[model samples]
Target chain A: MDIAILADAVERGERRAVARAITLVESARPEHRVQATELLETLARTGREAIRIGLSGTPGVGKSTFIESFGLMLVAQGLRVAVLAVDPSSKRTGGSILGDKTRMERLSRSPDAFIRPSPSQSHLGGVARRTREAVALCEAAGFDVVLIETVGVGQSETVVAELSDVFLLLLAPAGGDELQGVKRGIMEAADIILVNKADGDLKATAMRTCADYAGALRLLRRRPQDPDGFPKAMTVSALEISGLDRAWAEIRDLVDWRRAQGHWHARRAEQARHWFEEEVRQTLLAQLAQPKARSLMQSLSEQVADGQLTASRAAQDLFASLWPEMEQTKLPESLDATIDTP
Target chain B: MDIAILADAVERGERRAVARAITLVESARPEHRVQATELLETLARTGREAIRIGLSGTPGVGKSTFIESFGLMLVAQGLRVAVLAVDPSSKRTGGSILGDKTRMERLSRSPDAFIRPSPSQSHLGGVARRTREAVALCEAAGFDVVLIETVGVGQSETVVAELSDVFLLLLAPAGGDELQGVKRGIMEAADIILVNKADGDLKATAMRTCADYAGALRLLRRRPQDPDGFPKAMTVSALEISGLDRAWAEIRDLVDWRRAQGHWHARRAEQARHWFEEEVRQTLLAQLAQPKARSLMQSLSEQVADGQLTASRAAQDLFASLWPEMEQTKLPESLDATIDTP
Candidate 1:
């Protein structure tokens, strides 16, 4: 696997090569993971640029329809688009129903659009990790715009929001009273809220829902980096294709404003730091799941569950077992001082 | 230093002993942590049964007033009440204003009540861990009702929700439109919603707010373990002490219903499991903060922040350095199967 050659082909907008690269990155095999890292290093050096967007909504919110309409509009404007999804539920349900290629039939057929459903078989973190790598790949492949979609309303939405430059949440007109049904943290993460399915019979409801959301949003604390100072809510009909142009304009304005303010670069840097800490934490847990440690943890868990051992004590014992030297070695003076003070 | 004596005194309901035990648990010194764990283990063996409740609200919601009024009512019914708080802000602000002894003037002076403000200095998780231990100490001291209050809103409320049996979210009468200001996840965690400060001029507004909350809660999904199926909302006048008795009855009903249906034991087991995993993660992070690992992480973080290296690669390099054996060692067969499947 010559990563340099693959990186070169991906840079030249070779769709097949991009797909193969994504598959390699998503593989759980140890050797493949090593190679994937090498591939990413090469791709990173190419300095690919793309406007990344994260989109999310609850089930039955016309997320796929909205993405299809939104993606086609971008492609029509001569901007190559890529749609990637992060659906961890696919691991449990066997595959993602939300990001099925058939759902975006027209977008998938477009020459300027690349659609990749979530890697159907991975942990939530694994799926997020792969989706992030796929975003880099799409950028390297010369796609000017990349949209990352998440299914349902929970941590997946939060994860997508963190990885993308802008987060758009799709809601249906009937979701007005159901606003409470959506997680507040998810709503806060949205840079823009689009009331989808705002056509025909639902138009009146959608308009009312739009007003309700606007009022609701005003009461919430605004994100400091918000280009408009607050999250914007608007009505859109994915089926009728109304409001697509205005939506694009808002997204563009937000990106341009954030870039001008230097928040775009700062946010990416913060994201990098966040992923670093997350990876370190996950890697530590994986090591702990090894056989020797697993057995020890099991017994400790049983004791703790039975109220015979405290969780803190169990963790301390496991740490001692994993690294015997650490038990006797005191923290360095500099770090020790901070810990004591804290 | 004498954990046995402290444990015995705590079991005998000595208020001073209970306070001293909590202080020992909250200590950052490694030696004190060991003794605190020992004390908890002994206390656990005594089979202390108490109905643990977590109460949270944003600042200005009158959490202390409600708790004071509510606590005195329970004490009048021959119940011993203990109020413990988890406030990480205290570490930054130097002390908590939410759980200050002065805030609950009447309750603090009661012979049957014990009030412990959050430790003035500690991390969020550190405070939560200590507070959990304090809850056990309170139970050992024969308190039948333990109230764990969290200041303001955010992760602290979620942490408190996880540690308690029932979570009650208090709000002011004028908080109807401000509903969107509250985090959605926190609202979902509530087992009961109490509209406090409902008196005189605010009485009608509180009733309307209570109805609004009830309607909003109906739109949200209920927790599967909730004995009553959905959270109930009601208005209360803590200042006038009007709804204290009814609130206690509702709490008692929920607890009794859950215990009868076996959800109480199951929920506790799940909470224990969650804390076990949390402790393991935190302990690993602490170990990584040690002098040797700290220097390596700092350098890697700088590279990651500068965009010279991807977070994934940096984490891999760190993990390889920390556990060289993991690089070559295949996971144990049992764990390998699970890892491969995931």
Candidate 2:
């Protein structure tokens, strides 16, 4: 693999090269991981930037329709769009129903549009890592916009929101007051709430739902990073393609405002730092899963469960076993000595 | 310390010994920690079982009043009670308003009651570990009921709930519709929702609030482990010392039902397992904070923030450096080998 050639091809907007880059990053092999890292490093200096948007909705919320409509709109305005779906649930089933191109036939045919489904075999953390790397690849491939879509199940939406500049939550208009259906954590992470199916006979219901959400948002604690210090709510009919432009405009305004306030850059930096810490934690956990440590941990866990050993003491014993040198060193002064009454 | 003597003293209901046991567990000193573990192991087989309950509410929700009133009721029923307040916020300020014995003057003065404030120096994890150990100590000291109190300010409440058999969420009646003020995560964790201060002119409001919460709970997903598969809601006036018996009855019923269904024991086992894993992770994180790993981590973090290196790659590099033998060994088969595209 010629690193320079691959980087050049990706930067030149070669579709096959871009897909290959994503596949390489998503691979679980150690050597491929090393090469993927080198490729990312090589392309880091290219300075290609993309607007990252996160889209989420419950199963029946028509997330695919909205993405296709909104994505096509962006393409019509000459913006290159890439859609990356992160479906962690598919990891267990080893099949992703989300990435079928037939679901968005028109958008799939557009030369300016690229849609990639989530990797079916990876865990949520692994999928998130791949999605983030794919975003970088898309940017390097000259895509002006990257849409990260996720089902509003489990913590996948939260993970998607973390890597995105803007988070859009889609909801149906019926039974809008049933806010309990929406996890408050997801609501808090949302920057914009869009009431889908606002056209046709659902218009009145959609209006009421919009008002309901607006009231609810007012009662919620304000997000410090939001430009207005609160999330915005609006009604949009993705079927009719109505209000899509306004939604896009709102997203743009927020991006500009946050960028001007220096929050955008700061948030990205914070996210990067957070990802680094997560990687370190995950790697350490994986190391602890080795046979030697795993067996010790299992026995220790059993003792702790049976109340025969304290978890902290067991942890210390395990750590000492893993790194014997730590046991010989004097304990740090921060550890209170007076407590040893003997 | 004489582990056998201390364990015997704790089992004999000696308040001073119980307090000393708690102090030993809370100490960070290496020798004290080791001794504390031995003391705990010695006391582990005493078969002292206490009814553990977690109580949480927002500021001004009358948590102290409720607990004081409720604790007195339990004491009147010839039950010994131990109150462990976990206020992580107080750790930073080196003061705990929640555990002020003055706030529960009557209960604190009772020989049947024990109240321990939050430890002022440790982080939330440390405090939680100490509190858990203290719970065991209190049980050994013949306290038949343990009340774990925490402010619903952050993830601290979640930690408290995890260690308790039943979680009670208290809320004021005034903001009934403003469910946004109450995080859904906490609401979902609650086994019983109490509308505190439901007397005098606020009786009607409290009733309405109780109804609202019941409806909200219906809309929320049921916790799988709950025997009835849903949390219950009620109105209580701590100031008037009314409804405390009914609340206790509700808690007893839930505990009995969960025990009969075998979920109670299973949950405790799961919690113990979780604690062991948490301890392992926390200890490893502490190791990473040591000077050798700290400097390298700092440099890697800077590189990650600057986008000069990806987090995954940096983590791999750090792990390899920390365990040089890993570099020499062939990558595990679980780590796919096919990703080396070259």
Candidate 3:
């Protein structure tokens, strides 16, 4: 619990300290939250950073396989690797993506690699928020590369991208129609698209899919953040491990290009600003997410859904219900109450 | 200022009252906002409802022309109609979509039709939120149909979809690749895709484009909220005033189907719930959007951006600054401050 000692241990890359710090960040207890903030603030002074890569894939697209192979490869090169999964839908699916570290057995066993499952079991927004903190913890612990993996559920992939310097999309070999299923926001967010399972029978199919996306990417006017021939699509095979080296090389090239263009620092700063703003917004919303106010919202929403009350009227009533709570706060008198106490 | 009188006037379909109510909703003054909430709540009791059709098209796609023609046609049918524009990009573009009444002069002058431009010039979120209230005002004023038009900017169209009973997408004659330029989120949010400018030499090309999108729609699995043939694509010539009848008929058919399937009420209830929750969240965020808190956030964000402070550290400091403000409120002491004074 000693902030300085824990930060020093994290800087020395002590695995226990790293795990404990991550656990601290994940805790929802008020006192723990205070300590977590203190710990993070202390570690921030260390100024350590890692290549934060965000990886997203469709369900059953071999995401775990990809991360395992990818993490192992990084660790083998004498780089400490951390794999963190962010699955906001885990509670509903009853299958946490990284719940069984055995999925990444080899990587988990690697002394140079660290693996963690999704932080919160539910609350779509909080899972990704907590994962962002975990990524910072990994960076402070001296990891050379941190792979943040997320399934294409809700907005997890987009949230993961905010925590990452590089965003990678892993897709299975599919036709154009399947490509249409991919949300364009995520496609535009990707720095690189990898058509995975590109070996054996599906090799040619994966190549064709890659070509389709590559062509699509080519048609996209160059984003100011990226260089030419960048944001390109390629095929990869996690089982055969054939295309990873090239993919890694391409990632390095993109990172190097970005750094040379001074975009690396600018981008990190922008991401930092984004997260700070997001933290502020999320804190505000969390007030309403608390048990008392949530029940009131639910009851009022039921009235709305039943046509017993209009949405506006229900909203006004709820807003009025929280006035007493707002009165005691130094909030501007103009502040409108939202979360209602039971 | 009189909530009951205004609600009564609105229900009577008085144009002056409708416009005044909308302006009240748009005003950010504390007193005006309180009055607006009261008026909306009173109006909600009337239970008057209108079909809200969301319309979206790329700039230069003749959206205004389409709306004008479409609005005139409905007016000709003796149906009372209201046209509301939600343009979040108005400030930057310096050209609000419905700013010039001359753009839809004929429709505007029609006794049965009313047109109002975008409410907020900037602040993307507030524009659409205010427009939702405006739509409610229109509905309470006994308009049979309300057309919500938005340019393809940010998430305006998506927001419009939530406020609409049926969502329409208007597009110029273009190839399959151009379709790729359309965000898939908007594409899927659409109920019908109309290939505008389907007259003149572009007729055949429009038909081809229509066929291409129709084919794509066919490839998509049917959304449960829609019928089998719905969300299909077709060609329409807004200039020629042709195809408007068919489009209206298709919309009625879709509405009738959804109504019979029980999805219509369910959808509205869900939208109400969504808006209610959004109001709560937006209220919380509004606290920071105030002058003092916002300036603090800006300065701290600059620090984070300049790398003079880590994002977490800056966020922590900002959070700390907001605490004294929080202590005055009955807010659960759980809220860490997130905004600071200069």
Best by TM-score: 2
TM-score of chain B of each: 0.90, 0.90, 0.89
Off by over 4 Å in 2: A1-5, A91-99, A174-193, A203-236, A245-263, A323-337, A340-342, B1-5, B92-99, B171-188, B191-195, B203-237, B245-264, B323-342
- Per-residue alpha-carbon lDDT of model 1 for A26-90, expressed as tens digits? 77667777877888888887787799999988779998899999999999999999998887766
How would you encode candidate 2's per-residue C-alpha lDDT over A1-342 as one tens digit per residue? Answer: 777788888888877788788888877666677778888888887888899999999888888899899999999999999998887776432234344576777887899998887665655257667888999999989999999999866778878988899999999997744766778778888899999999999999999998888887888886768877459899999999999999999999999998998889888888888888877766655657667878999999998787667776787788878756543222143436354332
**lDDT (10s digit) by residue, model 3, range A190-300:** 999999999989999999999999988887768888998888899999999979989999999999999999988888888888877887676666767666777999999
Scoring each candidate complex against the real one, what DockQ results? Answer: 0.28, 0.35, 0.24
Candidate 1 or 3, higher DockQ? Answer: 1
Interface RMSD of each: 7.2, 4.5, 11.0
Place model 2 in a CAPRI quality band. acceptable
Cα lDDT for residue B207, model 1? 91
TM-score of each: 0.84, 0.86, 0.82
Model 2 chain B is weakest, by summed lDDT over 10 consecutive residues, at B326-335
Q: Candidate 1: where are CA atoms >4 Å away?
A: A59-61, A73-78, A91-99, A171-261, A325-342, B73-78, B91-99, B174-237, B249-261, B325-342
In candidate 1, which residue pairs clash? Answer: A184-B184
Each model's number of backbone clashes? 1, 0, 6
Task: Please give the CA lDDT of all the candidate structures.
Answer: 0.80, 0.81, 0.80
Which consecutive 10 residues in model 1 chain A have the weakest lDDT in total?
A: A333-342
Better candidate by DockQ, 1 or 2: 2
